[model samples]
Target: MRKCRFAPGGIYHIYNRGVDKREVFISESDYIRFLCSLYRFNDIAPTSNLHRIAYDVRGLTSNISDKPDKRKRLVNILYYALRPNHFHMTLQELIEKGIEKFMQKIGTGYTMYFNKKNKRSGALFQGTFKAIAIESERYLMEISRYIHLNPLKNIEPEFREKGVENIDKAKDFLLHYKWSSFLDYVSIKNFPLLINNEIHKGYFKDASQHKDFVFEGLFEVKPRTCKGIL
Candidate 1:
């Protein structure tokens, strides 16, 4: 594990990969199912029927969006990114063991869905999701940048280390990627219901400002400076 501690009001960067570093998100349906799972299993209430509601006959992932907005969330999902093999998330704990509860439900629920659909068994994720406590405000932004920039791997596997070759192309790819909260943070409405954007209120003036920070600010930061966050 990277770092371990779950305290209320503490923010953490949580992540995990598939067993053997296999691809956990294989198809569009798989991605949508996992995304829906993030929404359905985030609450303090017991997740009944699980992914069944997320994939009913009428809709694929849209069905789960119909859930009422009143359910209490265990953690405030600050930022997240789902890659082909692994996943990243920055969460602000809202209650006791909030991060633990949310991670456990997402892991167990998604593994069952993945295994049953793929006709495989045993643990789907690695031992457990790792955690990195964000001790300061500056580290929070850096961690979120690291998480959102992860999709660069899909474009160029070496972008993280060598820096983006074409800034515009990289920015376009990130803006269009639907899996991460980058789009939402930019106020482009990727998955507004899945995240709590209120946290960015005092930090950024508006969406485009944040979009600049994500695209331009990190673009200039030498990969060496991003060592610990990356």
Candidate 2:
């Protein structure tokens, strides 16, 4: 586990996978539980039972991000995509050490949930989550598209190397995939209460524009592979 240098206002791409490259999320409920942690554990305060907490709104985000601190947040979850074995997130630290604290909570909380559900007692994830700072807007824009395009690998196993075979098919899959925040970012509102979309929204003219930006990358862009820490 690398000791990540998290500073206030810095944006980074953080990712981790299951231990031994195993599947961490084996079912739908498993994925949703982790997603709930993304909402339930962002606060500076400690809490549990994500199954009950995600629905409360808790006023953590209150639909007003980047505002005066009514609720102190550890980090701003700009974007995220949850794969079967791994997960990816683009985050901006709201306070110093925010990312580190947030990741620890998420890792610990989700491991407990997963282990209990499966009747296993062991670490679920690999080493500490790895982070890479998004140093430029170009990288941010590219990473946003890159993250959204991740589902395409399920459809076209070699899409990144061979390029998308059918752009229409690619769009259709992404339009329906609910695990990622891609739908919400594109005005679909799959999970409105789950993420703070404002920071990334500022990069685009509108949700339609954001959707367009991601769609265009299917055939035109070949971003570097976003690998798991495991």
Candidate 3:
């Protein structure tokens, strides 16, 4: 196993791409499955195989008595974005070794589901995920802006380099983008269950302020020049 210097109560930007730059998410279902894994696999307790559980309970109507116990989360997922070939997350360790344990579960659980669905795989991710410690408040806010604006690459590939062509169009695109936590940050309630908003609350006054922060930084924020740090 790769050793990580993740510390308790520390924030880190975590990311990984697919093997050989392959597409890890081939379709909408693949994205949904991965999102479900993100929600289901953060527990400190061992869980039954998610794929198996879903299959076993297929077509069954749930009774009112089937409520499961609340999960003890390993880490606090501040924000996340899923792309076709890669993904990014802003996470804070909640306990000792929380980030490592959470990543292990996410990588292992999602790989099994993805490989089985695609019917061919040695490894889905390139290798161990990369992490960069957020050492300052300014750095944390900048990284958050970067992660949120990442989807603009799909529409405006040069936005990061030269700035957005049409800020209005870019903002609209981000507002409707479904694969990232951008919507949640903007108070759209897309995937509120997947994130812990305590950290974000301390940074932005509210959703409107958060949206303003993202848009206002478009001109000043430069493209990430370093590898494995965004």
Strongest candidate by lDDT? 1
lDDT of each: 0.80, 0.78, 0.79
What are the models' TM-scores? 0.91, 0.86, 0.88
Model 1 TM-score on a 0 to 1 scale: 0.91
Model 1, 142: alpha-carbon shift in Å? 0.8
Which 10 consecutive residues of model 3 have the lowest summed lDDT? Answer: 56-65
The 10 consecutive residues of candidate 1 with the worst lDDT sum are: 54-63
On TM-score, who's better, 1 or 3? Answer: 1
Looking at model 1, residue 214 earns an lDDT score of 78
Q: Give candidate 1 regions above 4 Å deviation.
A: 56-67, 221-230
lDDT of 3 by residue, 1-230 (tens): 33347888889989999999899888877777777677667889897667654421121223211456388888888888888889999999988988889999889888988888878868899899988888788888878888888878788866766878898888899999988988989988676677888878998988999999988866754645333343
Candidate 2, 112-203: lDDT as tens digits: 88888889998898887888888888888877887787766767867877788898989999999877879989888666666787778678
The top-ranked prediction according to TM-score is 1
| Candidate 1 lDDT by residue in tens digits, 1-230 | 65677889888888888889899999887888887778778889998896445453234335445655777889989899999898999999999988889889999889998999999999998888888888887888777777888888898777766767888888888989988989888878667777887777778899888877777554654444356442
Error of 3 at 162 (Å): 2.3
Model 2 alpha-carbon miss at residue 211, Å: 1.0
Mark the regions of model 3 whose C-alpha exceeds 4 Å error after superposition: 1-4, 52-69, 221-230
